[model samples]
Target: MTWRLFRFFLFQLAGASLGRFLFRGSSPTQGAILGLLAASALWVLIDLRRGARLLLWLKRGETAVPARVDGLWGEVADRTWRLIRAREQKAADSEARLQEFLAAIQASPNGVILLDKNNRIEWCNETAAVHFGFDPKKDVMQHVGNLLRDPHFAGYLAGDDFLHEIVIIGPRSTASRPVRLAVHLHRYGEGRKLLLSRDVTALEQAETMRRDFVANVSHEIRTPLTVLTGFVETLQTLPLDDEERARYLALMARQAERMQTLVNDLLTLSRLEGSPPPGSSEWVSVRALLTLCEQEGRALSVLLTDGSGKKHDLRVEDAADEEIAGSQAELLSAMSNLLNNAVRYTPAGGRIEVRWQTLPDGRAEFSVKDSGPGIAPGHIPRLTERFYRVDSSRSRETGGTGLGLAIVKHVTQRHGAELRIESQPGQGSRFSIVFPAGRVRPLQPV
Candidate 1:
C-alpha cells in the first residue's frame, strides 16, 4: 500500500512538472489542477487494465498458475487461485470415492441398480445386468418397466407400496433350468429408487423337496399300517380255521416287517444327513466288504424267490486287494445296498455281477451290473433323491424302502468317492462307486 501511495504521488509530481514546462505562462493553480486530473485518470486506467487482465485469465479457465501482478489485483489473483485448486482437489477426491463405491457394488453377489425419479435406469452392477439380461451401456436411461416387462415386476414398480419384496422368473429362466429372483425396491433421495435382487432358485427347490418328502413318508407308512389293521380286524372278528389263521398271521408279519424296513431306511437317511462325514482313519478291506455283500445278496435273493426253485446267477469278483479308509459299517452298507438293489431288480435266473477292482488311475471301484430293465435317461439324474423310484409298484412288490441309492450317494460323498450310473433301455444297468487314490491303499500281508 505504501509503495502504491508513493507511486501515485510520484506520477502526480511528474505530471505537474510536465504541465508547468508546457505552459510556462499559465498560472500555478491551473497547472497544479491539470496535473492532478491527468494523474487521477492515468491511475484509474492502470487499475482498469489490471482488472481486465484478471478477467481474461478467469475467462480462459485458470487451469495454469495465475500471472504475477502488483497491488490489490495481485492479492486477489493469489487468493482466487488457491480457492480454485482446493475445489478441484475436492472434486477429484469425490470422484475417486464414487468409483470405489461402484467397484464394491460390482463385486457383490446380489444385484444392485440405481434409478432416477422417473424410474429410468441410472446405473447397474454387472450382477444386475446378468439378472435382468441387460447390456449395462445400452440399458442406461431406459425405463425399468420397459426393460423388465414381467407382469409381477411391472405391477411391483407401479404400486406405491414397496415394503415387501417380490419373486419373479428371471428373463433368462427356462422350464428345464429355472432361475428365480427375489427383488425389492427402496425409495431414496427425492423420489428416486434402489433395486436389489437375489437368486432364490435353490431355496425354492429345497422347500419343494421338503414338502414332497413329508408327503411321501406319510403315504408309505399309511399303506402298510392300513394293511396290518385290516388283517388284525379279520383275525379278531372271523372264526378262521387253523390254516387260514396261520396264513393271516404270516401276511400280518410281512406287513409289519415292511413297515420296520421303511422306518429303518428313514432313520438311515436322517443319520446320513445329520452326522459328520466319514473319516479316513479306519480302513476296511475290500475283500471283507465283498464277503458281506455276497452273504446278504444271496439271502435277499432267497427271500425274494420265497424258497422257489428259481435263483439269480449272482457272481462276486474281488480282483483288488485294497483297503478303503472309512467307517466299516457305512462302506458295508453302501456296497450291500448296491448289491441288494441288483438282486431285487433283476429277474430270476438273470446275470448279476458284483466286482471290486482297481482302476488304471490308481483308484478302486465297487461296481454292480445287473441284467434288469434299465432306467430311462430322465430318471437317472434324480435316482439318488430320497424315495425316488423308477417303478414304484415294482419297488413296493420287491419290498424296497426306496432309500437305497440315496444312502449310497451320501456314503460315497462322505468317503470322497464318485458314484457313476450307466444304463440304457433293455441293456441293463451298472452302478459304480469310484474311490479316489488317496483313500485306497494296497492290502498289507498279514
Candidate 2:
C-alpha cells in the first residue's frame, strides 16, 4: 500500500514537473501550487485503492488477498487482513468445539435429538434413531409429530404443559419380549426443542413388580393373620366343647401352614433373584422330575378333597428320551408347582395329565394339562406373575401361595427355557415349559 501511495505521488510529481517546465517558466509559487494538487490527487487514489482492496478481499475469499502492500496503503491493508483472519480463526475454533460436543453426545447410550423451530428433526444420534424406529438420514427434516404419532406425544407437543415425558411401546414388543421407551422434549433457543429417549422397560417392570410384591405380601399375611386372630379369639372367649377346641386348633394349623408356604415361596423368589443361572453340571432326568410331580400330586390330593369329596386322578406321561441339564431341586420345584396347580384346580374325579416330549427342533417341553375350570384368556398372560390368582377364594381353599407359576417361570428362565400357557374357559388349561436345546438331553433306555 505504501508503494502504491508512493507510485501515485511519483506520477503526481512528474506531472507537476512537466507542467512547470512547459507553462510555469521557473516560477516557484506556480510549482508549489501544482505539487499540492498532485499530492491531494495521490492521496485520493490511495484511498480509492484501499476501498477497492477491501471489496476485492470480500469477493475473492479471505485467502486470495496478499499479505502486504506498499507504503501507507500496505500498513492499512495488513492491519485489515489481520483483523479478518482473527475473526475467522475464532469462528473456526468455536465450530470445532461445537462439533466435538455433538459427537460426544451422539455416542451416548441415551438418545439425543435436536428439532428446529418448525419442530422438524434437525439432527439426531444413532441411539435416537434406534429408539424411535427411524433412519437418521431419512428422517431428518421430518416433523417430530409426523414421525412419532403416539396420541400422548401428540398431546404433549400440542399442549402448553412441558413437564412430563411419555412412554411408548415399540411395535415389536410382545409377550415373549417387550421393548419400552421413555421420551422427553424440552424447548430452548427461541422455538427449537431438544428430545431425549431412554429404554425403560426393565425399570418400569421392576417398579411394577415391587408394588405388586408389597401388595401381595400384605394380602397373603393378612388372610392368615385374620384367621389366626379369629381362632385365638374363639378359643379365648367361647366356651367350646372338646371337639370344637380340636377343630379350631386344626384350622389354626392350616392357616399357619398357608403362611409358611407363602414365606417359602418368597424365599424361593429371593434365591432366584440372587443366584446365577443354573450350570450344566446337574443333569436331571425327565422320568425323575415327572415321578416327583406324581408323588407330590398324590400327597396333595389326599389332603385335597373336591367340593364333591372325591380325589382327582394324577397321571405323569413318560418320555424316556428326554432329560434336562439343570439343578434337580429347581427342576423338581417347577414340575411340582405345575402338577400341584393342576391337582388343586381340577374337580373331583377330574384327570390331571403331565406329559414330556421333545420337539423336532431338539427342544424339550413338559406340559401339564388338567380337566378343570380353565383360566380366562386375559389371565393367561399374567399367570406367571407372583401371587396372581384367577379366583382368590378357590386359590385359598386349595392352600395355594399363588407363587407356583411365578416359580415355574423363574426356573424356566434360569434354564433358558420358555413358558407357554394355553387355556380356554371350560376346556381346562395347558401349562408348558419349553426348554432350549442346550438344556434338553436324550435318555438311553436299558
Candidate 3:
C-alpha cells in the first residue's frame, strides 16, 4: 500500500516536472495541476484493464493465474486457482471412496440397497439384484414396493416402525426348491432408507428338521414305553399261570429290545455327526469287509424267516484283493446297514446280492442290490434322512429303527465316499457307496 501511494505521488511529481520544463514560459502552477489530473486518469485506466483481464480468465473457466494481472488482481487469481484445484482433488477422493464402498457391497453375500426420499431405488448391489430379481441398471428410480410386492414388506415400509426384520419368500422361490430371505430396513439421510437382505433358506430348513426330529423321537419312544407300562400293570394286577407269565415276559422283553435298538441307532447318528472325518490311515481288507456283510445278511435273513422254510436267496459276490482306508468299525457298520436293510425288506425267497468291485478309475464300490418290495422314486431321495420311512408300520414290524440309511450316509461321508440310491416303484432298490481312490488301494502281499 505504501509503495502504491509512493508510486502515485512520484508520478504526479514527474508529471509536474515535465509540465514545468515544457511550460516554464506559461502558468507553472496550472500546468502542474493539469499534469497530475492527466497522470491519475491514466493510472485508473491501467488498473481497470488488469481487473478486466482477471474477470476474463474466470469467465473462460481457466484455472491458471492470469498473465499481466499484477497488484491485487494477481493475488486474487492465484488464490482462486488454488481453491479450485483443492475442491477438484476433494471431489476425486470422494468419488473413489464411493466406488470402493459399492465394490464392497457387491462382494457381500447379503444384499444391500439404497432408496431415495420417495422410496425409489437409488442404487443397489448385485446381491440385492439377485435377491429381488431385479436388473440393477434398469431398476433405478423404480419404487421399492413395486419391485418387492410382498405385503409384509410393503406394510413394514409404510409404517414408521423399522425396529425389526421380516422373513419373506424370495421372488424366485418355488414349491420344491424354496428360497427364503430375511430383510430389514434402516432410516438414514433425511427420509431415505437402507435395505439389507440375507438368504435364510438353509437356516429355516435346519430348524424344520430339528422340529421333525424331536417329534419323531418322542413318538417312537412313547409307543414302546406305553406297551411296557401296560404289560407291567397286567403282570402286577392279574394272576396268571407259568405259561401265560412266561409269554407275557417274552413280549415285554421284545418291546424293551426294540426301544434299546432305537436308542443305539440314535447314539450312532450322534457320534457320526460329532466326530471328525475318518483318516486314510488304518486299512481293512476288502475280503474281510465282504465276509462281515455276508454274515450280517444271513443272520438277519434267518431271524426274519423264523422257521418259515422260505429264506431269502442271499449271495455275496467275490471281492477283489483290495484294502479300504479308515476306521474298520465304521466301514463294517455302513456295509452292515445296507446289507441288513436289503435282507429285512426282501420277501421270503427273494434274491439279495452284495458286491464289492474296483472301478477302472481305481475307486472301489460296495453295493447292495435287493429284490424287495421296491421303494418309490419319490422316497429314494429322502431315504437317508433320519427316521424317514416309506411305510412306518412296515418298518416297525420289521424291527427297523428307521435310522439305518442315515448312519450309512454319515459313515460314507466321513470316509470321503459317495452314497448312491436307485429305485423305481416296481423295480428293486440298489444302494452303493463308492470310496474315493485315496481311500482304496491294492492289498499288500503277505
235-306, model 3: which lDDT tens digit per residue? 999999999999999989989999999999999889889988887778889999889879888988888998
Residue 32 lDDT (model 1): 72
lDDT (C-alpha, whole model) for all candidates? 0.91, 0.85, 0.90
Candidate 2 residue lDDT tens string, 1-446:
57665777777777676656655667856875676686677777877787677667657776545544555656777787878888889999999999999899988999999999999999999998888788889889999888887887888888877788888876457877898988888989999999999999899889988998999899899989998999999999999999999999999999999999999999998898799998997777788778878888899888787356677877787777567899998889998999899988988789888888888998888899999999899888788888889998999998998898889989989999898899999999898998888887776454
Alpha carbon deviation, residue 376, candidate 3 (Å)? 1.3
Task: Record all residue pairs in model 2 with backbone atoms less than 3 Å apart, i.e. clashing.
Answer: 1-69, 1-70, 1-73, 1-74, 2-70, 2-71, 2-72, 2-74, 3-70, 3-71
Candidate 3 residues lying further than 4 Å off, grouped into runs, are: 1-71
In model 1, which regions exceed 4 Å deviation?
Answer: 1-70, 241-243, 444-446
- The TM-score obtained by model 2 is 0.70
> Considering every candidate listed, which one attains the maximal TM-score?
3
Which of 1 and 2 is the better model by TM-score? 1
Q: Can you write out model 1's per-residue Cα lDDT over 1-446, one digit (the tens) per residue? A: 78878988898898887777666686766877787788878988988888888888888886568756666787788888888989999999999999999999999999999999999999999999999998899999999999999999998999999999999999999989999999999999998999999999999999999999999999999998999999999998999999999999998888899999999988888888899988877788889889988999999998897656789999998566778899888898899999999998998888999998888998888899999999899999999998999999999998898899999999999889999999998999999999999989988777
TM-score of each: 0.86, 0.70, 0.87
Cα-based lDDT at residue 218, candidate 3: 98
